[model samples]
Target: MSKQPQPAARAHNGETRPSYSERLWVPVWWWPIAVAVTMLLAAEIHMGAPGIRAWLPYLVLLPLPIWVLLWLSRLRVEVTTDADDGRELRIGRAHLPVEVISRAAVVPATAKSAALGRQLDPAAYVQHRPWVKPMIVVVLDDADDPTPYWLISTRHPDRVLAALGLGTASEPEHDKT
Candidate 1:
């Protein structure tokens, strides 16, 4: 694939330039589950059936394990600086514009703090992997979009935050009740 030149983004009225593009894929830890499932399937076929023909099917279905891996790995996320002077987050087949983003924060990798995947905001547009470490939580402007926010996993969350120009100011303001 051809690499696009990094572009300067107007983030919260300030210019934030992205230095490089990165694609985040499925974490390495999930592959073992796929292998286990495939092995279980093979075992079921081998022990349950009483004929020699039953084992023959396992050979034909040898690619099933790889297929499972490929399916899980299909969600590719590309973060880059576009020529339109906007930071882009290309997750799966969707492209999210980071220009109108209002807030961004880094989520910790601990069990209680790793609020990713199904544990995140239901109204949010999320693309998360359980095996990935820290995640980036981005809140978009509610006026222009249907998705309330986004929860994405990234290996280099600091760079992703930099690309979005989300510093300490990205934190939400709490009411003094």
Candidate 2:
């Protein structure tokens, strides 16, 4: 598939499609949320000493996870192609190209936890699991091997796959008499 976006394509009959780097660095607050929550948890451990004041600092940590959840809810995906044939997956500096990816797909309900090595979510109940590292699976065409896959974990799976022009394989047809 062609990597270039249509030159004629316009965002709102006025705006143009963002360039590769511009698209890549757009910040999603989810990263900060993840960072903050981690810091809060660490602060709790540090402050959990032996005095009555120790309890107050840890109590402040209770809301850290909630902020992470809210940030996750607002997550976004930004995708683009690199200088080579590889594709770039981004959500605020967290990027992975096709080479780093072992597999990708619009994981089906029947898809197993082969990636995770354990079952937790229905997406994980299948053969491969995402290992809790959420990713969108993109099955590629014209690939050399059977694993024409690029796995990227992003909050916006649908948008990421659509931007890359990748998709899942169609099931085989049944034989008739």
Candidate 3:
């Protein structure tokens, strides 16, 4: 039996550059489920005791975090090329269009954390896996909305930049002064 061939890199204007997009999903651990279950159980136990019935409203709010997590997990980016124009880009339920993209590039790991205006949270946080950096950030070409940047966690930052034609040789020369 012959093995199936994998999809080849997509070509744009005779140049082979695959479209790239990264989706943000919840870590594939049982933690979300465990948290949901623990909250349910704790709420049940708290409500079971006498005189705690008055606090039922608070107990009912225990599931809010789980709902939030599920909602966030559904957030994803869909990157593709426009067959007619042949411009590669990504779109999502909540993202600006690729046509609105002004710049894209791989930022060194240290700069990535700082550029996002994010602080390392010691308690609980999502730290990009070391192997995933240097991560790619795309600055969108919008003025009214102003801040339109995407700090995507990806292993193939170069491929992503190439696909969008944002990592051109001309860009680096300007930064080397």
Candidate 4:
């Protein structure tokens, strides 16, 4: 039996008014890496001192349990964009009200050069997942709260931004030089 709990809205929540919802997990790229690491550990254990090599299988498989737990826990995240009833953007446990959201934009590719150099306020909330690419930048209008924005990694950044009434990302100008 899997100890990791399932996403909400499937169980006792009973609320089914979400306009948009998506579940995101670690990207496909991580799978091979995980396997490679496991193999590497096994290889190392097999080549270790005779006494230590006796525990080869156990040592190599050790990270498996930890990997599974992490894969279930931190590597998976649910993104819920509820407009009709909740009027909020939900990513895992944290949520942002649609009303408080000022604006949203797809993080430009050039942002890599800047290394997250755009609109980084001191009191912002960031929910970053290493596996996800093309994160969305959401600005907040709530003056009461100190948080300036939310930088979240999502597979469907456009959809999430659109759920916040941000529409689509503007195409950047290309240089022809």
RMSD vs true structure, all candidates: 7.9, 10.2, 11.5, 6.1
Each candidate's number of clashing pairs is 0, 21, 0, 0
TM-score (all chains, Cα) for each model? 0.65, 0.38, 0.49, 0.68
* lDDT tens digits, residue span 68-170, model 4: 7465445323434433454557766676667777788887555733535565666667776655666887787877777777777777888777666669768
lDDT of 1 by residue, 1-177 (tens): 112443434354455433445555555666777677776777777886788867765775667767766787666556555455666765666666666678887776773253653466777777776667777777888575677778877777777777666763344789999
lDDT of 3 by residue, 48-156 (tens): 5667674664567666667666665553334556555455444333334456777777767778667545642332112244434566667666665545466666656
lDDT of 2 by residue, 1-177 (tens): 223333332343444332232222223565666667766775767664767665655566656766646544443345555444445655443444444444455544344345333433332212222323435565444343343444444444455555555544446799996
What TM-score would candidate 3 get against the native? 0.49
Q: What TM-score does model 1 achieve against the real structure?
A: 0.65
Q: Which ten contiguous residues of candidate 1 have the minimum total lDDT?
A: 1-10
lDDT of 2 at 156: 44
Q: Rate the local accuracy (lDDT) of all candidates.
A: 0.65, 0.46, 0.55, 0.64
Would you give me the overall lDDT of model 2? Answer: 0.46
lDDT of 1: 0.65
Error of 3 at 43 (Å): 6.1
- Which clashing pairs does model 3 show? none
lDDT of 3: 0.55
Q: Which runs in model 2 stand beyond 4 Å of their true positions?
A: 1-62, 68-75, 80-87, 96-104, 118-135, 138-150, 154-159
Best candidate (score: lDDT): 1
